[model samples]
Target: MSNMLLTVEQAAEELKVHPKTVLRYIREGRLQATRIGKAYRIDRAKLDAFAGVASGRTRPPHGVRATVIVEIPALTTEAAERMATFLGAAALGGDAETRPLHFNTAFDPTSGDLKIVLVAAPSDAARLLELIELQLGLSR
Candidate 1:
């Protein structure tokens, strides 16, 4: 057990149970959680302690991280600017599982060609895309 933060879903995956089950544990005061706004963050140490008490052995917390890169082309200047701004903000405001996001932009005003490069951890990639889509009003 170490000082690691995991979401309820991740904890549930580690415990081989549903996320709702994790929530139930939290509600029942069986699992320790830190409520962050609407979500719950579980500590790795506490999770391992709980597991040891439950199963008579401690299980190591899973810590796997992946880097992901995504590129978008044919974006308008306004859209590219918005995406860049959002990426910058998101990088600064990563949650428990999210890593820093890196963004690169190449825009040619004369040719109206805009290319955006997004680098982020896998856990945060989906969220980054959702934000991009929301900001740009794009379906992709």
Candidate 2:
């Protein structure tokens, strides 16, 4: 019985809610708990069920959305700058009013790999890729 029971404070911590909220749930019959003397004891299973419901652990409303992380190899400072400008332009075309997309550029002289990471919406991902291909002469 002790193992299956949790105190109000413990349940509140597990649920990430205030102790008062737990008490309110108990009073409102939202949570199934027992009054032991002056303390409230909640069943572990019931607490878990309530947590799943309150946290909306159900399936996503719609289908899953995909995010693409495009990486471009930049060999020189000029190439890196060009990649940055291309990504900036794509982000502007996609959503200029909103926050700009994130762009990361790193040059490894030893490896001779200039890396650029562009994080943007799926719709804008193709434009960015096309720009990189055009810059690198990879596309005919």
Residue 84, model 1: lDDT of: 60
- Model 2 per-residue lDDT tens digits across residues 1-140: 32389999999999899999999877755577899999999877667555543223354466233355545543666666666565544543431123234456676765657666666544455666777788788997
**Please, what are the lDDT tens digits per residue for candidate 1 over residues 24-138?**
8787555778999999999886676555433333334663444555556666778666666666555556432333355566777666565656665566666777876677677
TM-score of 1: 0.42
Clashing pairs in 2: 74-114
Q: Return model 2's CA RMSD, one decimal.
A: 17.2
